[model samples]
Target: MGNIVKSLESSLATGNLQKMSETMDQFEKQFVNMEVQAEFMESAMAGSTSLSTPEGE
Candidate 1:
């Protein structure tokens, strides 16, 4: 009985670890994609004008 319980616990632990690892991987991928989008937006905003250009200087 004790051996069976131990085995079951170990299996559960392994499964949980695997799930956590997958979650972490997914989160990292999402974070990287977001970062890229942010960078693109930053660059775009830097050179963008608000349709208000002054007359010829």
Candidate 2:
């Protein structure tokens, strides 16, 4: 809960995609395990990104 939020926030601040993904996985697991009702929201910008961009390109 709070931990995941902090972790994900730090990841976002540092632009750490790996950390973000891992934190999100944990977050999702917690919610699903608790049977928490979820509603996902998305905007058009959600689909307009690549997962990989080389470090020094």
Candidate 3:
């Protein structure tokens, strides 16, 4: 993510629209992957907690 932002800044400074667009595409893909992983982790944590609870409480 940091590398992508740095590349985007470099592209903007050099006025290279193509490189900027490619960097943005890469950032978008990385962001979506992080979101999916977060959701899966949250679901796994919830499942584990539910299974560890005492029967009457």
Best-fitting candidate, scored by lDDT: 3
Model 2 CA deviation exceeding 4 Å by range: 36-57
* Candidate 2 residue lDDT tens string, 1-57: 999999999999999999999999999899896663332323223433333545575
Backbone clashes in candidate 1 total: 0
Each model's lDDT: 0.65, 0.77, 0.97
Q: Model 1, poorest ten-residue lDDT window?
A: 48-57
Question: lDDT per residue, candidate 1, 1-57, as tens digits?
Answer: 354455546656787776555556666776799899999998777656433455552
TM-score of candidate 1 against the unseen true structure: 0.59
TM-score of 2: 0.60
- Cα-lDDT of candidate 1: 0.65
lDDT of 1 at 44: 76
Answer with 1 or 2, whichever has the higher lDDT: 2
Per-candidate clashes come to 0, 0, 0
lDDT for model 2, on a 0 to 1 scale?
Answer: 0.77
